[model samples]
Target: MSARNAMAAMLDELMGPKRNVELGKDTKVTFDDPDICKYYIVGFCPHDMFVNTKADLGACPRVHDDNLRLEYPKSDKFEKLGFEREFLKFLSRLDEDNQRRIRKNLEKLKANEENGQKKEDLRKLRDEQEIARIDGEIKLCMAEAEKAGEEGLVTKCQELVDKIEQLEKQKTAVEERLNNTATIPPPIDESAIKVMEVCEVCGSMLIKNDAQCRVEEHLSGKMHMGFSKIKVTIEELRFDNGSRGHLLMLLDISVNVKDGDHVNETDHVIEIGEGGLDRVHEIAIVAEVVRATDIVGMIVIGVTGTETIATDDIVAK
Candidate 1:
């Protein structure tokens, strides 16, 4: 399986089943059947009433009070240290086996980070080595030009100098990246990062915050709509065998009409469902059968004459 799919599966296993917590009238705060305090799971729960007033209360913590209602951390704070702290707290709450699973996932992430760093270091080393080689070549060319004092040798030496200068500039840029401590951010544990869920319709992975909007957009998209239409057509085909023609017409099928059998635009009446055509407006034959494989049959077209005929509307005749 792919790395992303594996990680998703591991995350699903780690999270287990979702709790069925119901939100009260406020909607901002969840109250009913709270198996675990949301804030406690996130490393903090400041509801002192649960501790002081109800010392031995068996029921869940009541967060209905205006002061007690938990507010989500600011987006910036969550991006910074909040996620890591909360995830650690969550790990602490899990059983030994669950924690072991989480730790294994974390180790894999750390190994990936190390591997990435090693590759980047190797690339930088190669670049530096290339720069050194270029510098040495430039020096050798300069010595040859000086000794020979030939026009061609001088030109070659200048070219080498120009090439070395470019290499040196690149080397300096690489050095800057290597030396810039401020630009080097601390390595973060991948487990601290929020796990994303895959969209069932589009097969795209998305974070919880943007999942709803993405899912709605995906459902309304042309590809999804087309698939939905195809699904409906299949269902219709299964139930209404005689009405298959209507669905086929919707798809703009090309029928092969028999040889010598011709349809007159003025004479034939088009019937769609219970309605009949008022008049036969126009008929244009796109192609005549020039091959033996082409079907040769009477093409009976049913449509309201006033309706506009598309290029795809013409069937074989």
Candidate 2:
């Protein structure tokens, strides 16, 4: 059985049937030992593998039982409205101050939506008034055309009629949109938190909070800060243009490398220089070029290695 299932089985055997409990509240459970994972109390335990491996007792059984009973917050109802789990997790990770800020932002979003609806109603009213005015103009033009018996007056009356029809069609479309907006719930703005940044090291998009909890969590994450000692080297080499002058070079070498042919093949090896240096560094094919026109006869490459490649170093393949 998998470690997760095994743990579940163990919990069932120890705690009877799984029952709900209110989270963030003290539970009545008796334990002989005091060494327990605090994260397990809230139901997020990252060291489950260690427990299955018998490296340690994992999380205290009582804590796990208590977590299973912990009640989810009422705001979690947003999940039913199609709010993503990540968004829910983001909200939970926020401190009390940030949570209040998020609530305020949600109110603002609703207010903005209401204001927009008012503007749309006003615009629709104006369109209706314009349509009424156009109808009067068309009637006047038609009477003038009949009195004068002129082709020019008749054409002017026809143009006025067409303009009124167009206005009516536009007003109908606006009315439909407004009705739909009133009936359907608006989508929650993911960017309502306001403070957001992309991690430079891993390119992970992170949202910030007033308490800086999210930012600190992201920066301290193992995936984000794990490669601190790793370095990449890229060598740029320029070849003579032959007869096309310096502007038209035969080859433009960059540190970045991409191989379209072996994109799906994970076992392929990339060799650098004529010497066939095997264990160079990490090579990632960030993008695939299906058309030759995209590269313009020049290869694009990005390299990550032990040492930073300098412009003076000549890298040949």
Each model's Cα RMSD = 24.9, 21.6
**Reference-based lDDT, residue 263, model 2:** 36
For model 1, give the 10-residue run with minimal summed lDDT. Answer: 284-293
List lDDT for all candidates, in order: 0.41, 0.39
Top candidate when judged by lDDT against the true structure: 1
> Candidate 2 residues 210-305, lDDT tens each?
358767776676544432211110011112212211111112212234455533333222222322222332121112111211233233233334
| lDDT tens digits, residue span 70-103, model 1 | 3333232332323323333333332233335446
Which portions of model 2 show Cα errors greater than 4 Å? Answer: 1-94, 150-317
For model 1, the superposed segments whose C-alpha errors exceed 4 Å read 1-96, 150-167, 170-317
The number of residue pairs in model 2 that clash at the backbone is 13
What is the alpha-carbon lDDT for the whole of candidate 1?
0.41
**In model 2, which range of ten residues has the least summed lDDT?**
229-238
